[model samples]
Target: MEGFVQNTILITGGAGFIGSNLCEYFLGLGNKVVCLDNFSTGHQHNLDGFIENPNFKLIEGDIRNIDDCNLAVKGVDYVLHQAALGSVPRSINDPVTTNDVNVSGFLNMLVASRDEKVKRFVYAASSSTYGDSIGLPKVEDVIGKPLSPYAITKYVNELYAEIFSRTYGLETIGLRYFNVFGRRQDPKGAYAAVIPKFVMQLMKYESPVVNGDGNYSRDFTYIENVIQMNELAMKSQNEGAVNTIYNTAFGERNTLNDLIAYLKKYLSEFDSKIADVEIVYGENRIGDIPHSLASIDKAKNILGYNPKYSLQDGLKEAVSWYWDNLKEK
Candidate 1:
């Protein structure tokens, strides 16, 4: 909290789910927040609360444009680079655009932050960067070749961050987020994560199709845990911690069936009929891993990280938010 005082934080994709949460939390702590979002995947409704805040300013700009990146970085003390087109399927369809935005645009942000002399640059990395590596619990040092265009972009992000820190001496931290989910995570999109998608389908009494026999598991992280990681990365004075990456997750895994069961059970609390929704099994998605789990040992030891919400704890809060915020609308 004391770290945010007199700090000006530039959250690149501030209109998106994770970035907006950062904006809200930092603004609450009396920090000046400047949000830059092209709204490619982010929504206008996400900014409804922050737009009116005197401490929060939204920059309606794209990261691909170097001028916009430079402009947003000016007079900023720290940066949380969350801007990028996210979605494996979308990248599969348009690798060029994904590379341009995720890779080239990330370069732009690094350059801007370096030139502007921001104290620290923390970015939203992906667990997909772990790629096709065979391991039960993913560690920071072990990674395999990327399986898809999206994964490649994310892995390249780590490379660029490493290069920037090594060459330009820009302080940096990368949080490899695993299956981040919670409020404002767009469920309407074709590439929506399983949790919110299932929640929406069950709410409408529509059958939620499992991408496989509901056996594929993932480290479903809550948005609040993500926010905590970002804050720790931003504030930590640990010399060894800076310029490194950390796994931002709840340290547990859940199968797709468990996701649906919880969604039905929780949504049923609001509407009893939701519990009756049937789940349909389907083919597993191509390029999707069979299971994913993270070792939070690095984050815990280095960044002083402690995840406050587990998958179930997060789902309860998330379900309530969706019911109150999106269900009625």
Candidate 2:
């Protein structure tokens, strides 16, 4: 990240979980960060820590608007497009809004980045892009038909990024994230991810629900590992690394049952009574897949990605954060 002091990076959705983390990291590295957010899905408190920092600036805008996208991309060295309506059920309920924000908004960013001639355009792809393939340990290539509206939107992102790269000659990198979780992940919404939701439920002594038989598995990735992928994608000097997608994951899989077990074990450290909390079983969710796993070989071999945190390592940190920062709320 050295020599990045001269860089002015625009992080769309800068108030959201993943984007806020990017803003914090870039600011710490002495980079100028312009955070463009609508606050529709992103929280304001995530920016409270760095709001007054000289290296930081916030633009209250949505990526769905080209004018807003233009303003944010102006005078930027790199664009990290993380703003999107995430969640399968949410998209299933309202595919129109999802397409507008994810697909249309992504196009806006690409056009703005191309017009501005930014060095690179990196984006958040999803493991759901491997939908219906029944492939174990998904690779960068060989994807299946999308299973949900959200999945289709994410797949379109990869396709657009590739076309934008070839046609406009803009450098683009797509990180196909597989079930990412960590600090700042919101647990209040109806579409909250399983990890954060379960963590909070356990903290309150509420019975966490395990959809189906609790045997479904995922390649749950940590936030720090995602940050590593973003940094490498932005700074890679390798010609082969540009304009391709990489699986940003821990390269391992664990079941939902295993997830709850870890949550109970870790939470009990702070409150012994939490060890007795029970989990409730529910019917399988609509459009839910059985398992998701990622093969990180392409990322490791191409982008030089080395994941430092295992599921256990990340869960320890995440559990502690929820306990200290969100416990009283």
TM-scores for candidates 1 onward, in order: 0.98, 0.99
Highest lDDT, which number? 2
Q: Write the per-residue lDDT of candidate 1 for residues 1-329, one digit (tens) a residue.
A: 57578699999999999998989999989999999999988988998987999888888999999999999998999999999889888899999999999999999999999999999999999999888998979999999888889999998999999999999999999999999999899888788867778777877788999988999999999999999999999999886999989999999999988888888888899999998888899988877888999999999998889999998999999999999877845
lDDT of candidate 1 at residue 163, scale 0 to 100: 96
- Candidate 2 on 1-329: residue-level lDDT in tens? 57688599999999999999999999999899999999998999999999999889899998889999999998999998899999999999999999999999999999999999999999999998998888787877888889999999999999999999999999999999989999999988898988989988998999998999999999999999999999999999986999999999999999999999999999999999999998899999887889999999988988889999889999999999989887965
In candidate 2, which residue ranges exceed 4 Å CA deviation?
Answer: none
TM-score of 2: 0.99
* Candidate-wise lDDT, in order: 0.91, 0.93
Clashing pairs in 2: none
